[model samples]
Target: MQLFNSRLLRERMQRFSFPAGGEFKKKINVIAKWQKSLRDSDLSKTKEISIQGLFLSKFFGEVLGYTTQADGKKEWNLTQHPGNDIDARIPDGSLGFYSSDKSATKAVIELKDAMTSLDRRQSARRENFTPIEQSYLYATKYDGCNWIIVSNIREIRLYNKSKTQSYYESFNVLQLEEDEQFKRFYFLMSKDNLLGDGALSPLDELLQTSEAQEKSISGDFYSAYRELRLKLFKHLRENNVGYDSSILLEKAQKLLDRVVFILFCEDKGLLPREILKRAFERGVSSFLDSDQRVWLEMKGLFKAIDRGNDKVSPPINGYDGGLFAYDGLLDSLRIGDAIWKEIVELAGYDFESDLNVNILGHIFEQSISDLEQLRSEFDGLELHTSRANRKKQGIFYTPENITHYIVENTLGRYLEEHPDRLPVIRILDPACGSGAFLNQAHTYLQKAWKSAYEQGEIKSKDARYGTLFDYNPAENDRTILLNNLYGVDLNEESVEITKLSLWLKTARSDEPLENLDRNVRCGDSLVQSREIAGEKAFEYRKEFGKVFEEGGFDIVIGNPPYVRQELLSPELKEYCSLNFETYSGVADLYVYFIEKGLALLREGGYLSFIVSNKFLRANYGKKLTGYIQKNYTLVELMDFGDLQVFEDATTYPCIITIKKTIPEGPMTFKYLRLETLEVADLRAELEEKGYEVTITPDSGGWS
Candidate 1:
């Protein structure tokens, strides 16, 4: 019944040695009386006005260091008051803090009646006018306001206005008074924290703490994935399967990826919850001493998952079969019941609760070691080592931050200027190894569609934009994903993995997957067979004819392979020399991808690539540089000189954004010198001096 437990408040007061002055002490005592009055009231409801007057006013004035007029002692006062609609109709109340040179409203407070909880979802009728929405609206309107507080006496939510979404932190007032560790929460909303330009200091601290917590969580998740894979491999080996050590390793890696996907599906409610647990229990009882029987049962389950429920004896309605196409391999392999049980138990973690696809992608990335590391460990084993070698040959995956930045400035900015094209804009990743850029593009499209939907810009659920926001794959999500995202990779396995990753991204309960082959192809992007072999020769154009015939894509982005000239096959080397104007004897392979990507872009289409920075200064880059200056409008150039973008690698990476259009005059290219590895620092610098440099490309070089 107490507003805050009296003893806990007293302890906090003494521990922090908070102002024990006469007026503050009296104000605190008065707050306790108001709590008693609210608690003892016979009325079924307490209005918002009473809550504001009795509790919020005293708390802000005395505890949080805000000026207030004394009861029966004040004349006309000009100082701002923490009350409802203080210069804004949206927020319930706002507080203004002043400095010597400036005075501005620093925070907005949204209050509800004692009976109303701010955390609960409102009824459909009132959903649009929820407290959280109101707080966000007010914060957005006020240029100086950086904080939003929503409270219903019992629970309090604090949001940082600077975030994309203003939902940041929350707390229980009573719990804060009781726990000493919770005292840090005060730093977020304290008067001292809001002074001058230091308001965001506390938010920065919170971000650091949150980042540390995330890293710890990611480490744990990685360890779990690693342990599970090793155990699964050991079990398979013990069973004496026909495959040799090398084959076993490859199969083991694929099986581990499938198991992870299965776990993810279950967590996301695509599969029945605890389905793995039940399967394990049943196997233990039915196949008690028979390892072969357990393996057979597991094989059947995989087959069912692959063919989906419609084709199986006992259908699992929602699954798509491509991921489990290697069911024959599973049937041949024998796994012990105990091993099955351990794996099932491991999959039972609540992955869907806090983990998103982005985080899961990171976890999956850590599950497998690079080819070079793996080859060193398994000596004399003839593993499928070409993929690993390719990775080492500068086919590194792009980091999410870099991907997002490029996509935002290119496709994102394009869409903003041409809103009507959101539904039809086509995106391509020519050398999509694992579909990182494509996945990011899909995510961006989803967000854009969601925003459009919320703003009532799009009306029908059947609209092309609807596919982006549809969570259920049976709906339009899969269609939108397939129609919008196109990719090509040289490695077939990489193509399959890219398809799988994209499927995982848009997967929902009970949705059948459309054939992804049409969108994601496997071929060498640079050289067509006809170009090398003459008429009737093999060509990638025949495979990806649809995109080629359509006059190219609306957006093309990727981190292309960076093989050296010496590493290129004789046919490819000759083909590049004959066809590409930018080809030089010492030019790296990525240079060709750049020319290919440009060729595949329609006029005014955007193209972005994170490739070797050597093209900026190398002797062989003169042709490429000249070609770019003559043909494309260079939108941005982010040079990471000597800063390694890939982990444990030593290549200087640069991100270049260009539009497939000619420039009329000296174009101001947004250039950033990446002095640090941190993306945040780069972003901050980009905001300040990104457009400081300008250049016009002549036939020779940049001027």
Candidate 2:
């Protein structure tokens, strides 16, 4: 099982043995000391800076020098007072430094050792700060200096203050180390990685220590606490559990009753700790808040503590033995069976052990002969689910038809001929919403695994391919699924749902199982950094590894998000320009994600995306088309022309597929021309079961 490190907040609470007030005080002190050091520093001179300049420096790091201007050249204007007399002034050593020649204040420099949290926020939230709002105030208050540069004691940023338009354009010089005999103040800002190691702060170390302790709470204790709390709350609402401290007595009575019943039936004893951990891991406490935790603890105390002796029972559950043993025992009981059934039904899976067949959606309907109870269970879910948006439906599945066609036309042909070679395929969906594309690809590979297992090419199925029934896939085949399917998305909720979707779909046709942190994960595909945990949490993956040198994904497929040009956040637009080499038409965020996805794949990785048709017909889309024409080989264009691909979605969407490395010739592209939203015949379909059909245009065409 994969263990996630405890977060900073939890760690602090654990170590402090209370709350965050004291720790926050310490953080404030540290900030003060850092600020004082900058004020006292002898290396540079300071001047009164505009609030906007201070905020900008705090955010983007202090500017050392301009690329175009000479040292100590103040070319820009930060003066709020229009006719203020500008002249030489002494540096105050807080906001930034003035030039030595002092002709025009070209740069602002603020010193620092480590970056503060507020430093980065300054770059983006320009309109929110108080000081920056009064750039004119700074100009009238002090003479000279148009810019401000603040450093995290390492990295420096240069901001050109443009208060008239209300923003600052800034750049980072990365890491700037302390030096002597510098040619000019600006030269010091030229280097990157100012300090070695970039070690974590003392506070960070303390936080990590606290996190280690929180996860150590035993399962039995947790479970007992939870049950008592839930019962107490239910009682409080219904007036049953009682109003006094005897709520504990009530919970104890309930547990004792269960114990009596169980003891009567069998010789086994119950451990509460093991039960609680299992519940947490299965997302049982997902909605529980701090109040609920306190209630549970209080209720557990009243029920479990021996009143006269004033002592709680010794916890019987151990992490591996007692905890897991309890889980195994529970799994055999009616309660466990019911819970597992619910999870299975929610994921929309169906598999037949006798026929060795697996179906994608609506599992219980075909598997179980009795449907009355299950139908009622589904009805309850509808009421619960009505509040959620489409992203929650688990219905935004990648149409399998598109997958089969893309894989066959690109990777399949090669795999079919080779036969013996394991397809060293690496597929990525930059905006892999709910792992739809990966799920489809994973299913295809599972079929391949079953085929290999049947052929007796391998032995011993991995836990991933294990089932409750007789069906199993070869170990090698399971590895194929594990290795080939990887996706990244920014939505935390979507990432969890997507992981569950992939896990449910990929499980052996007849099984109940679990996996800890596989290929699916939460992340911004564009802003991935090496600092982030998780294998798929790639920071700039397009720039490194086999994918960069050899090319990226073998099959890329998904419905990338369509963010409007007017709606693009300034930070997002700027981010795209800084990272992506080629982009089109303030082209949608989806377009940028697709371009990044394509570039990350191997030479011939096929990309199929359900994109907005605006790129096909809109004026901005023209530039996007021109870009695709120049870079990619348009292999298949399934244009869902005039289709309401999205009912609730505002954008008129289309599906297009292209290969990264297409051979020279008139490429054969398929066009799916839709006439209406309801017409099944109008939808295109590939030759695969459960794959939907839509209206399609001719297959062979020139770009």
Candidate 3:
């Protein structure tokens, strides 16, 4: 079980480099000139300003070829310390950049020092898309190229308005005299070519003697194999190396062969022919010759065959078409249309919209009981705890009432309008702990589809069952899951829980559950900031092929994570800054998801989500609002009104629904201002008001 040691591998990678000598100095001079202009102006360093003038000057200089004037002085004049004691001032010497070209200037950049790293700046950078946002203003006022660069000395990155691309370009300086190790880091930062070609890379570092690799491989073969696979994938990605599909498949075959050869040789002593024949009956026959078979069989003579019916064998059964071999594999794979159908059914919203209030409302109440039991079960589990208190410390389930409201209010109107059509929806819950949203969504679709099927308005089909639950048992099931939903999160455990919830919702109670690996995946959605790479969640988009070749989703919906500013990882934050091109500042991970959801949708598609009420009025939310106002028709907005939707929530929550393409507005959506909601009335209330609702917080006004 060989695995690449990332720390050591990174050290190895840093040994290679290409220098940036005089070219680096010229860039620095441009920074100096910009800095001079800022120093000559009225703006000075305060603990209160939110803009970093000197860094902005330098960044703008580089982005626009040293062309921006210090016209931002007036905007910079008003300065007050953040009352919350958060770092509010646009500090002196902060680095920033902007593009003025219409296509490129649509993007924005902000730099920060101290509390502001490339990561922190990115949050603010990802959400702001205003015509005169600090980043946009800088770009517009500076009037230059269509990209912006913002950085502190340790890291530098860019924002491209033209392509809506943002990403960190360099981790460290690219000086000629920098240490060799540092140069390797520079190479990684400066050139995407330093990484591999294509997207897939194979694992081959299994023989490394390093401690990390050894630590990862010291477990059982299966455990070691899994770890090694992850390492292999990570190594290729970190180095930016890519390989072809044929290469990846070939590598997989070779690795499996090596495993079989080693296991057989050790088990049979000398690889005896008779033993090989038995093993071959299970599929090993396809890979070995007579000599290898004989060798493998000979080893079996010395091997201990300790027997219990439950003791797993290398190949549990011979290839019998009547039994659990191929069928099991197919079942596990859940390949193609079979899998797709399941997902679409699970994600069905059309029925939910058409259902009368009494029936759907009753179903939601029953779900709440199930959720409470789930919460109790998880609360008893032993796991790492991040926050204090017992109830809030474990896997959080969305209150059933809230889930019902989210589904109906956010999606009901659109679904009602197109009852004849199954709206192809794409939704993601960035921190989908226990998969409350996906589960609720699955139920929403299932109930709707079932009703239609019962009424004979739609014909539904049954799924085929397989005898064996083997390697590909989930293959067909996977396809079913893919059709309905897609999600990404950094929490592996949460992903697992999400899959289980989705499976439970889709499976028939009387039949043995289909052994399906779900469409839900584990990843940092913001990490891919620029390119999605080989992650399965992203793969779904490519696998479908239609969206990439034709267009994107018809609808995007979900509840994104609510990670506080201080809790985020630096790498994740940096990646967000470099990749997410919309707004920046206390970015709220949910904000990026909204931006991504919007991007993944087709022009006329709808976008919906429930987020912090703060964003509705926060300065950070302004650019996002502006972008939505300019590009989308605000179909509806619902303020749940000071309701503690989360058991642990300290802030008010708001739900917003909009369509991607707005046709010449002065559009007035329905508006609802409610004091509080009973768990039972959520669906009815939202439905009665219809799609044209505007709900405003007590403190903020809405037009």
Candidate 4:
């Protein structure tokens, strides 16, 4: 625990030796044979059990020098639960040491075949790339264990338990082919190192070094994003002049979204790395000399991205989701060369890693200095102030924990019940502000579809895109984004961000982005009739006739926006009164969203929304409560009473999940009230609480 250097630890590990070097040498030759066989055979035919025997057991037993027995008694637990008081659930295998003449588990070992990837970004990873988020869960759950060793046969990685995810070390199998790589791998991971010559193991020394480095580093993606945003805002405000406030704001927002996405593409390898950075540097000189536009470098790339392979200097594939579409006003606008220098400098930092899309779409934080200053500078325009715009429009940020909960219970339940429906299932987020719900849903289905593909449950013909023989789960991630995920936002910019977020989430290099404008639309989701809202009217049967004809969506779920009754226009109130019998008078804006969302649900379909808890007790909610009582089957409900779920606002909220089927018996549903605002295994917590509610016509006050 005292001051330790990774260099000194490595030198010590090099001196430590195993007595069974002959066995290790024989295992190395066997590994080469297995590697050749893997290359020769179809990876699809490779069995995980075979991999466990062929690669995993030998490598761990020989190279890493972990023993299976102690005192002639077996000391390794295999193919069963850890058998601990905490987290008794079974994992693939466990690495252990001898203690009390029995195997004492050290780390949960998960072995994967060639099928799944160790890549963190790919959907093919199925969100199982460990030591990131899942490791934290394992750290606490795996009894007193603090480590997990995971491998996909091709590579092996080691992660230590932490309250938060810390970076880990990965030793690829290819490392065994080279002396230096093998030495490094053996030094850190060998059983001799774990049982060090000194008081602490080398891995323990490395952990201390990493933890210190982690503590020294600070600041998050939002801060970095805000800094970059400030620079852009200042440049836009000072330099641009030919347009009105709205146009100017639109140009600024669009340019920022596109640039961030392009930067993301560069990091993802979807576009050539440094395509923008190099071009920006090259264009600085060309800008003052050229007779064409001022920022010609980006314009050319934008055009090439829009037109597919038609134009290619920096070599970009088409990404036409309205993000790269010709924005004449935005493209033509020129900024001082100095701004581009700052942009090129900041572009070196990875935005995709830093800027998460969950809170990225529109600037929602009212406390941000840039937004507060922009509000003052814009005077009364309300251009850059998205919080005001969002409040007025009745949209808010939905947390991923919330989204994951709702999506799992709703879409997750549906998928579990009908696994065959993966190819044809439909999900929608009517008020998908920045595509949080849609993104969650996309990820959920991506994992399901990928698992099904790996298990041979999904046939070649079931592929969403490409030929039968060429069915790829990676490409299907895009097809699923295009086909399965659907959303509607009143804000045009929000709709664009939704599309951009989805594109960024699943975009493949040089692959055409399926135009998603038709899928995720921009309109007032509550307004249906033309006479009521005219151009903004989003009639379900008319605008989404295909969805209607297909018996509406299979699941409709999201965090419907929070807007008070007073914000409703008289016309909107009247329209609501005439159209919906759910909530009488000018109810909270979320009430109308509920009625519309449930109405759009296919029979036996599910609809869930986390909205104001006031509807359960307030006099205004009588109509809605009665309507749902008589018309739908309540599945589950959670009163997040007094528990502050949203960071931006203090509101009493409840999550309600409904099945679009009229009740056949007394109103009974699983329900609970959270005492604390912590994100954990919600389903397990609900079951552990063991609470339910029943209501009848003669029911009295329950609280």
Candidate 1 residue pairs in backbone clash: 306-321, 309-315, 309-316, 529-538
Say what the RMSD of model 3 is: 25.8
Q: What are the per-residue Cα lDDT tens digits for candidate 3 across 1-703?
A: 0122334545555554433477656655554554443456432333223444444444433422233425543222111112222322221221122234322122234444322333211223222211112332344333332334444433455433221121123333324224553443333322132212222111112112343343333323333333343333333233333444233322322233223332333332322223333433433343554323422432232132211112334322111111111222212211122221222221122111122122222233222223333334342422233233323322233554566556544444444444443324444455565566665555555434533433344443322222222222233233335654655555544554455445434332122233324445676554543344345234435434554454666556666665554555566567667766655647666777777777777666677777766666777777666666666777767786687766555546677777777637355565565556542334334434435534332323353
Assess candidate 4 and give its TM-score to the true structure: 0.75
Model 2 gets an lDDT of: 0.39
Q: In model 1, how large is the Cα lDDT of residue 378?
A: 59
Best by TM-score: 4
* Cα RMSD, model 4: 7.0
Task: Score candidate 1 by TM-score against the native.
Answer: 0.69
Best-to-worst order by lDDT is 4, 1, 3, 2
lDDT of 1 by residue, 136-236 (tens): 55665666666677877655676655442212556655455433424444544555544424555444454445555556666777666666666676667
Per-model lDDT: 0.63, 0.39, 0.41, 0.65
Writing each residue's lDDT as its tens digit, candidate 2 over 679-699 gives 211111221111222222332
Q: lDDT for model 1, please.
A: 0.63
Model 2 — which ten-residue stretch has the worst lDDT? 349-358
TM-score versus the correct structure, for each prediction: 0.69, 0.41, 0.41, 0.75
Measured on C-alpha atoms, candidate 3 has an lDDT of 0.41
